[model samples]
Each structure stands twice: as C-alpha cells, then as structure tokens.
Target chain A: MNNKLKQLDEQAVQYIAVGAAVLGTGGGGDPHIGKLMALEAIRKYGPVRVLSPEELADDDLVIPLSMIGAPTVMNEKIPSVQQMAMPLDLIEKELGRKVTAIMPIEVGGGNSLVPVLAAAERGIPILDADAMGRAFPESQMVTFYLDGIDCSPITMADERGNGVLMHAIDGIWEERMARAITIQMGGSASICDYPVSGAQAKQSAIPHTLSLAYDIGKTLFESKDSKQNPIEALLEQLHGYALFQGKAVDIRRRTEGGFTKGEAVFEGTDAYRDRMMRLFFQNEFLLATEEGKSLAVTPDLISLLDQDTGMPITTENLKYGARVVAVGFPCDPKWRAPKGLDTVGPQYFGYDVPYVPIEELAGGKGEKL
Target chain B: MNNKLKQLDEQAVQYIAVGAAVLGTGGGGDPHIGKLMALEAIRKYGPVRVLSPEELADDDLVIPLSMIGAPTVMNEKIPSVQQMAMPLDLIEKELGRKVTAIMPIEVGGGNSLVPVLAAAERGIPILDADAMGRAFPESQMVTFYLDGIDCSPITMADERGNGVLMHAIDGIWEERMARAITIQMGGSASICDYPVSGAQAKQSAIPHTLSLAYDIGKTLFESKDSKQNPIEALLEQLHGYALFQGKAVDIRRRTEGGFTKGEAVFEGTDAYRDRMMRLFFQNEFLLATEEGKSLAVTPDLISLLDQDTGMPITTENLKYGARVVAVGFPCDPKWRAPKGLDTVGPQYFGYDVPYVPIEELAGGKGEKL
Candidate 1:
C-alpha cells in the first residue's frame, strides 16, 4: 500500500478484525464485539478514513488508544459509543489541541478496531499502523515503550464518564496505574496513551499492520472456502511455519492475576501421530512445544485455530476435544532487538527457553524476512 | 488556642505527634516515626513556622500532603527525607507555583507530622488545620471532600523517586487510584492531594487541629508526670468520657482489604466490674459497646489506653490480659452533620447502629460544645 489515504468499509473491517484475532495469540480480547462496533460505526458514519504514517505532517499529534482491563470484564461491560469516545475527548481537552488521527496501541482482536470506533465517532481518521504488531499483557511491552517515547500525559475514562489523567515517569508505571484504575472503574476503561509527534509515529509504529491483518484474514477465509489448505495459505502469507496438527486432548484454564493462564495439550495426528504438543497462554498464547521441546515462544507469534474452519481460538474459548492446528510466525523485526526481548520475550513471561525464530526451529531459512 | 503564628520546636513536635496519635482514632500510622522525622526537620531547619488559617492571603496555595498505604509497610520502608519531599516537589512543578504552606491531609499519627517534615525542607510554614481532624481508611472520607473541593491534580512519589500525577473527578476516585498506586509503588508512598486556595482551606479544613493534637499530648505528659489522673485530664480537655476501665480478656486482629480490622474484649473491673466492653476497629477504632449497648461509635473518637500508666495504645498494640480503659470524644461538628455522617459514620463502616454523640451515650449533655 502506498502513502495514500484509504477508506475502510464494513467488509475490510471484518477481515482486519478476524486477522487481528490470529495475531492476538489468544489474548487481545474478543473480535466479535469489535467487529460489531466497527461495522455499526462504518454504517452510521461513512467508511472510516485510514491514513498511512508518511501522510501525516511533522507537528501532528498522533495518539494510540485502546481498552485496558480484564477481557472477561470487557466482555460483560461491552463498549458504549460514548465510553469509546471518552478518552479521546479528555485527551483533546488536556492537550489543548485537536488530535490529528487515532491509532492502535496493539494490533490484536478488539484493540485493532477500538481506535476505528473512536475515530468514527470523532469524525477523525484512523492510522493504518500499530505500536505492537501483536498484543502483550502489559502496556510497557510495546515498540514505542522500548524506543523510549513518553507514554503520557495519558487520559482514560470509564463507562460512567468518570475519568483520570496520569503523567507517569515511564511506561511500566503507566501499565501499573492503568490496570489498577481499570479494576477500580469496574474492570474496564478506555485509554489514550503513548502520544507522539507524526514524525515519531513514522519512526516507531509497526507499519501497515492493519493491511497485514486484513490480508491475513482475507487469505484464511478464501482458503477455507476454496477447499485448499488454510494453514498452508496462512503460513505463506506470514512467511511462517505449520507447527502442528492435532486434536486437543485436555485443556486446563484459570484466570490469574488479571490474565488467563492455561495449558492445552494436544495428541498429534496425521504425519506426527506419536508426538504430543503443549500450548501455554497468559492472556495471549505464549509458548508452543512438541514432546516438551521448544517449538516457538514469544516475542514470536504462536496461534491456535480450529483445524477444519480455521477460526482463531481465543485463550478464554479454548475447549477440550477440539481438533486444532498451531502456527508459528516471526514477529515484526522491531520485536527481535535486545530491548524488545527484554520487554516481550518468553523469559518476560517466565518461560525458560531462549527465543529462536520459528523459521530456525522449523529447519527452514534462518534470516529476517 | 488563639489564631496566632506558632513556631514548632522539637518539644512541640513531640507533643503534636503524640496528640495526633489519639486523633488517629486507631489508624493514621505509627506516631513514633512521625515524631522522629518532625524532630529531625525542626533541628535541621532551626524550627518550622506554623500559621493560623486566617493569616493566609486569598491566593495562597495550601496543599494537603500525607503518607499513603499500609502502616505495616510504612514502618518497614522508613521514609527517606527525599521520598517525603518528592511529592511536594512534583506538586510544585504541576501547580506551576511555589506552595505557600503544607498541611496534613488528616491529622492522625504519622500523617500529622509528614507536612511538618515537608514544610521545613521548603522553608514554608505549616498550616494549623487539616482536611480531616482524624484519619479514616480512605482519602475521600475527609471534611474537605464533603465541602466540594476537587481532589486533583494530585501528585505522589514512591521511595524509588518514581512519581505519578493524576487528575481525578472526585475524592473517591482519588482514593481508589492513590491506594492502587501506593500498592504498586511497594505499599508506601507520599502524596500531595486536595490542593486548595487559602480561602477554601479555611472553610473546609478542620481548624487548629495541630494545636488540638498538641494540647492532648502535652496534658497526657503533664498528668503522668504530676501523678495526677491522666484519664481525667484527657476527658476534661476534650469534654469527653471514660466509657470503661477493665482488663483486656481477648484480642483478635487481621488485615483485610488494606484496612486493619480487629476486636478487643475487655472484662470489666473497678466500678465497671461484671460488665463487658467490646472495641471494634477498622484502621481507626470505630466503636465501643458496653454489654452489647452502643456506648460510642464513629464519627466519634474511640481510643484505647493502658489503664495504669495512661500511655496511649495503638490498635496494633492492644494486648490480652492488659489493664486498659476506653475513652470517647465527639468528632468535629462538621462530621456530625448529616452529609459528614453519611461519609464517615458507623454505617459507612458496616456498623448497624445509628451514630450518637459520646456525651449523649454517657447520659450527659448532648449539645455540641
């Protein structure tokens, strides 16, 4: 895609929403809610305008906004149009200027579309990029945070129009306070964080992430309908690997410390009948291993999907007795840096394995895509 | 106490600190630490000036500053001079003006002395009044909150020099966010909350609270030294009553939801033999009942003391088999109003009884002194 403005219709929104679920790695939050919001927003206001980062002027204020809280609470609370627009309204007043555009803090499930929902309400455009190519549990585990952009002065508002403005010294403090505030606000709140100049947006944001999610989603749908191998098409689009194919034997899940932590064990079938695969998740899927050996770990994308329909399975929805396939893909190159690993790597999630690209683990090419 | 400027020396600091402990009702924090800090500050700065609320200019900025978090953690953390000063420094930067004076958010235990420590560092006078005459579990449970003062833009700092600034809609939000922030900062932090102009301060703050605390402490010391009845002097000073004198038979304690809740039962002795007194506490001692009859309940002050020595006993230090006495005094008149009672009354603490003045329960005059 060139640096021209684009229009996002209902169809594009659905594709991007579904694709973001795949990248969510099981954590980001349900996409159905975001899809409904996005479609209604597009229909109510015309198709939202999507601008490439290069199209923004140097002095423009680009803010990344999304929902911060337990996905379980978010599911029950549901987003109201007013609640979605609240953070942006407060930010504009605090900054004493109109925001140029809204962007996603992370491209995962509902987060990828929350900015779209807010921007449509404000009659503003949405940016085509995201701060994190995928979602992580904490706010500080993003490229912007790693690159040392100030995450505040940040503003957030709950469903009741109660609001808080925070100026924190670092992104870790931002995540800590934001999580606490979300719980205080009855488990969910909307936030406008990581404000940056248009120039900084171009430098730090993961580029074309919306388009990437859209294409990834579109391909998955087409492959399933055409009776071709959906998993293979997904691997091709992401330049990734087909990690495993199996039937889920047992799934153990628990919500702990505000994140869903679980393990799903799969008995391999097809070409790998005797092997066993294990998947672990904390909000998002964090690790995939075969025979207790490392297959893939974050900050690499590891996702689980229904084997037949190729529907992405969220951490909260992972069920026993379902046939599934696990796919592994390299994350954005920005996530491979030392600082990025310190922020989002498997060790950051308390896993013991050193992070290796899925391509390397798959005995394929061992270079950046 | 007249509306005159006062200078606080080490001796005066000790009196005020001890007096504040009684006002703490039972929470506030350990007064010993506050006493030490106040003495150190007065020595280093050559005594701190304290002003009457009427002496301030209309435009003078008065900030209520205090220590927030678990008193247990605070005791271990042992605040550094820099940590205590950090909140003031950040607030000054946020306010864009030098604060004219520092006042305690609540004149209870250590909270009463924190402002004195900060004021000496900035070479500013301490305010003789406080937002709350005594400490309650939360920041919103203050007279200033009842009088319609916005609780933010508020600033707080942890021991590590990490800082946070929040703009909240009301004191409840302020308390919620500040409590969470304190926990995140490792369970103890310094906060500058409820910034108000001098005129507003006079209208809302409980007047001359420092002197009230000072006199309480001075008399307790004097009565003990003169071998006169300390309990009589204490009751006479506050126009209160000695509800019971007995031997503590049982004491049960636990920390719950950030507040300390406990029950101490004392078997009657002396003139109260064969009767029973029960003391229930949540941070502050909330109630005293004799034979299941409500003798004193918040927002009335209830305190426990060593019967023989007349030394004040904190809720945490209440011991079984120790001879003790229970004292009851009326809270500020502001807290007796319907709105104030609604905010900090016994009902707010989950007690079933309607609040009655200590004097009324004692079968004496019920009118406000």
Candidate 2:
C-alpha cells in the first residue's frame, strides 16, 4: 500500500469517505453528510495538505476535530463550515497558540472527514492519523485516553454560535461535560479535544488510519470495476472475516442521551440462510451476535456493507429488508491490551458476552459459504 | 442609608447574610451556609475590601462570581474555597488578564456572599454593586442582560476540579449551557460571568447593594434591641408590603432541571386568619397569590420572614407549621422596565399571572395587622 497521502482532493475525499465508513463500523455519523461536507470544503478552500505524524515537530500543536452527538440528529442537521471551524478557533484561543495541524479524533466516517473542513478553512495541514484507530461511541475511547493523556482544554461549537471550552481533569469528565453540552446544543456539535504536542501525538496516536481508509475504499472501487465480488475483495485485502450475509428483518433504534442506541436483527440469506444475527450499537456497532454467541465484540470492527456494491452502511442508514454483508476486522494490536479491553470491551457497554478475537471466533479463515 | 461600606468583617458578613436573604425572596440558597462560608473566609484571609461601582475605572475588568444550580443541592454539598476560586482562575486565564474586582451576580442569600471567598483569597476588592438587586432564578435575569450587555466568556467550576469556560452568543445561551453544566457537576457549581468594564458596571449594576444588605440586616438586629418589631422596621425601611402573616401549612418542593421548583401554601393568621396564600418559587419567589388573586409577582421581591425574630427565612428553611410573615418589596427600577419585566416577570416563570407593582397591590400603606 502506498502510504504517502499528500493532499485531499475530490477523488481522495471520495476514497477516504468509503474507507472510513468501513473503519467506522456502522457509527461515526452518516458517511454521506461527511463526504459532502469534506468535498465542498475541498472545492471551496482548495485541497487540504495531509501531514503524517512523523513529520510533525516535537513542539507542534495538534488538535483533533470531530462531531459529537447522535448520528440520527446529525443526519438531519448538517453543520455549516463556520460551525465546523468554531471549535478550532476556540481551542486555539484557549491554548494561546496557533494550531499546527488538525486531526480526526477517531477514524470514523464522519469524524475522519470533519477535520478536513476546518483544516482547509484555516490553511493548515490535516494529520493522517487519529486518536481512535477505529470509532467507539464515547469520546474517552481514544488511544490517547488509554495512554493517560490529559484531555483538557476541550472546545465545542454548535450551529447557533454557542461555543464552549472545558478543562476536564480526565477523559471521562470530558466525555460527560462534552456530551451534556452536545445535547444542549440541539443534539450535535463540532468539537476539538485532546490537543497534544507533536511528541505526544507521535507517541499515542494510531498512525496511518486515514491512508488505510483510502486504500480500503480504493480496493472496493477497483473490485467493482473489475467485476470481482467486492465484499470478497474487501475481506481479502483487510484479512477480515465475513460474519454474515443477510437481509435485515427488523431494526430498533432510538436517539437517547446524545447517542443513537439500538439493535438490529438480520435473517441470514444465501448459503447462511435460516441463521439469525443481532447487531447492537451505541453509535458504532458494539457487538454482533448470532443465536446468543458472539460473532464480533467491540474494540474489534464490525461493519455492514451493501452486498452488491460493497459500500459501507452506517447504523443510521441501514434499513429493513436490505441485503448486506457483515464483515469483522481485528482491531489494532494496542486494543488487545488489558486497559483497552476494559475500556471498549463488551462488558464496558453492558453486554454479557466476552470479547473473543474475530479471527478466533471465525475459526481462522472466515469465508462463510 | 449610609452606603459607605468599606470592608466585610464578621458583623458585616452577618448583616449581609440576613439582608441578602430578604432580597433573595425565598431563594438564593441557604443563607446559613453562605454566612458561615463568608465568615470563615474572612477569618482565614482577612477582611475583603468593598468597592462601590463609582470606585471602578472605566477600563477596570470586573467580574461577578456566584453559585449556580438548585439551592437544595448547594445546601447539602457545600463547596470548598478552591471551588469558589476556580471559576475566577479560569476566567482570568481565558481573558488573559487579572480581575480588578469581583462582584456578586445578584443580591441573594448565598449568591450575595459567594464572591467574598474568592475576593478575600485573591486579595481583590469585592464590588458593592450587583447585576440583580434582588435575586431571580435564572442566570439571564440580570440588569446587564436588560442593558444589552454581552454575557460571553462565562466560566464555571465544580467541587470536583471540573472547570468549564463558554463563549455563549447571548445571555439565554449562557443560562442554557451553564445550567446544563451545573447539573452535570453534581447539581451545583461556582460560576463567573458577565465580566464587564468598570463603566458597564457603573451604568448597569444596582449600586451599593452590599451596603443595602448590611443596613437591612443591621435594622433587623437593632430593632430587637430597641424593643421594636423587626418586621415592622424592615417594611418601613424598604417601603415593602406585607403580603401575608400565616403558618406554613404545606410546601411541595423538588429539585429539577438545576432549580428548586415548588410552591408553599400558608394558612393565614391574625387579621387575615380566614385566608390562604400560595407562594411559588423557582430559586426565588416569582409569584405570591391569595385565593387565586395575585398578591405579588416578579420582578417584585417576595421574602418570608420568621414572625418572632424577624430574620429572613429561605425557601429551603421554611418548614411546615412555622409561623411567618411574607413581605413584598419593589425590585430595582431597572426591573420595572419592559425588558426587565419580560425577563423575571411572573409569566416568564410560567405562572400565568401578570406583574403588578407592589405599591399598587398593597394599597400604598401595606400595614396589615
């Protein structure tokens, strides 16, 4: 994989949108809105420069910019460019320094692209790294938190011009305060948090996740053009497991406490017919289970793809009766550590199941037909 | 009416406590805790200097500091000195300037004295003027808001080291965001907002309120020594109307949405023995009614006083079967203006009653036996 992503143009934004959605695991807000926002920003302000973590100077200030709140609300309420950039402005003002670069807090569909708008507007580079290698529902689920980084001086802005800057003692407090503010800001807000020095970013950040997303997206697009099975091509590229191929039968979703939380039941189709899978989510898909046994649990990635087009389906976009392919990829090795498992594992989300690795659960080569 | 208040000693703190409670109008949290906190701060850090609005230079940076959230919660969860000063520290850090003086946001029981702890600790003068001459429930119900002053750069801190700084577009947004944060900070928090120039303070603040509070408290204390009825002296001093003399028969209060919201029912005594009064409050008493007719409405002040001692009683301390005298005073003339009435009026608190001047409702004399 060529990892030298230098700029985000229209084509690059498209590829990253699809690839980030795959990494998003049915969460991180609707990818369509994020893609449109990023594309519009790139078109208006010219291409945003992509900076790898290694290139950052030791003292350079890097801030992660993203959207916080229910994906359901975000789907209907699209934020303006000013709203997207307000948090960056606030954080810069609070820190009394100009930001060196903007990074996504998570490598999720919308969050991955949200930073591009601010970066382009400010004429700053966008870092090709993220705090969370893959998305999790809460703000505290970032790798920075696991590394014991201080999540203070967090900033947020809403569409109505309300701006907030918080100094939380820890990541948990940041999540609690930011989520409450998000709910008050009409269920969605653009946020800038976990501002780190270049050295801290280099030490704690999950590097090259953006490049990974771009590659994934490109693989799917090329597979489609070549008339190969796109889902199969995706599984092969990521060494992912095909958890299930099913038609969505029932979906129960509700927006509560600034999160889209619910479950969906799918009736297996094709070679996996007669089997049932229940997928649960609190923004991102947290767990996938078949007949009470775990197919994939959080800290790993579980994404739903359009069976034919190989496009990623966000939790907000998945519909009943749609045939989809569920794929599972092992998470970054860091997440397998004790602290990471305790943080985003099944039990942390109140699930009774254990977090068995996707590869182990899939019996090594999970090509279910 | 000697308004030459120079410093806050033990005696001064005692008087302001009682007098502010009277102005607080049965809200503003428990006066006892405020008095204790102020007295302790005075003992530890020496007397806090008092500054009149006229003493401020036009460019002097003045900030009002106070407590936010349900008084019910604050009565139990008393904040530490650091908690009281954290908001000041945060606001200073945000503005990149030291505060010239700290002022009380309102002339209410606990709120009126909360700034003393910070002022004394910082060795800065405490402004004798306040935005609200009498207490109102929400943060936006201030004279500064009425004068169209900006309430941006608001800061808050909880007992647990969580500090928040917000740049709200307006006062209403400040209230919404600050109140939400207050609830998240475990029901109560210390806050600093409406930081203004000394010129703004002189133009918009209710001047010499701390002195007025002291006089009110002194009158009540001296009246007992002079063998005069303290309540009668208080009514004469403030030109206040006695709304009712009754026993607290029932009170239904609940802490909800960062406010102590409820109503107190009083069974009349003495000359008005056959009547009943219902006093409704959201932090401060917004409306007082006798048999469905409005006796008083906000931005008029309605305070409950102990019948024997003539000491002011907070809404939290007004127990069942306690004999009391409910007094109504005219709010500062600023609150009589259209914008002021619109802000703290009975209708604003959803009482469905129109605001009427206390003089008109009391038949001028207001000397009901």
DockQ of each: 0.44, 0.84
TM for every model, in the order presented, reads 0.87, 0.98
Per-residue alpha-carbon lDDT of model 1 for A12-98, expressed as tens digits?
A: 888888889998888777788888888898888878889888898988999998888777677778787888787787678668799
The DockQ-based CAPRI class assigned to model 2 is high
Residue-level lDDT tens digits of model 2 in A1-369: 666799999899899999999999998867788899999999999999999999999999999989999999999899889998898888888788999999999987798999888888889999999988888889999999999999988999999899999999999999989999999999999998899999999999999989999999899888887978888888888889999999999999999999999999999899889999999999999899988999998889999999899999999999989899999999998888999998888899999998899889988888754
Q: For model 1, which pairs clash?
A: A27-A283
Worst 10 residues of 2 chain B by lDDT: B360-369
lDDT by residue (B1-369, candidate 2, tens digit) is: 875799999999999999999998887767899999999999999999999888999999999999999988999999889999898988898788999999999987798999999988889999998998888889999999999999979999998899999999999999989989998999999999999999999999999999999999999999989988999999989989888999999999998999999999999999879999999988778889988999988888899999999999888787999999999998889989889888887777888978889889888879665
Q: Considering summed lDDT, which 10 consecutive residues are worst modelled in model 1 chain B?
A: B360-369
On DockQ, the candidate that comes out on top is: 2
Two-chain complex of model 1, DockQ on C-alpha atoms against the true structure:
0.44
Q: Tell me the whole-model lDDT of each prediction, alpha carbons only.
A: 0.82, 0.91
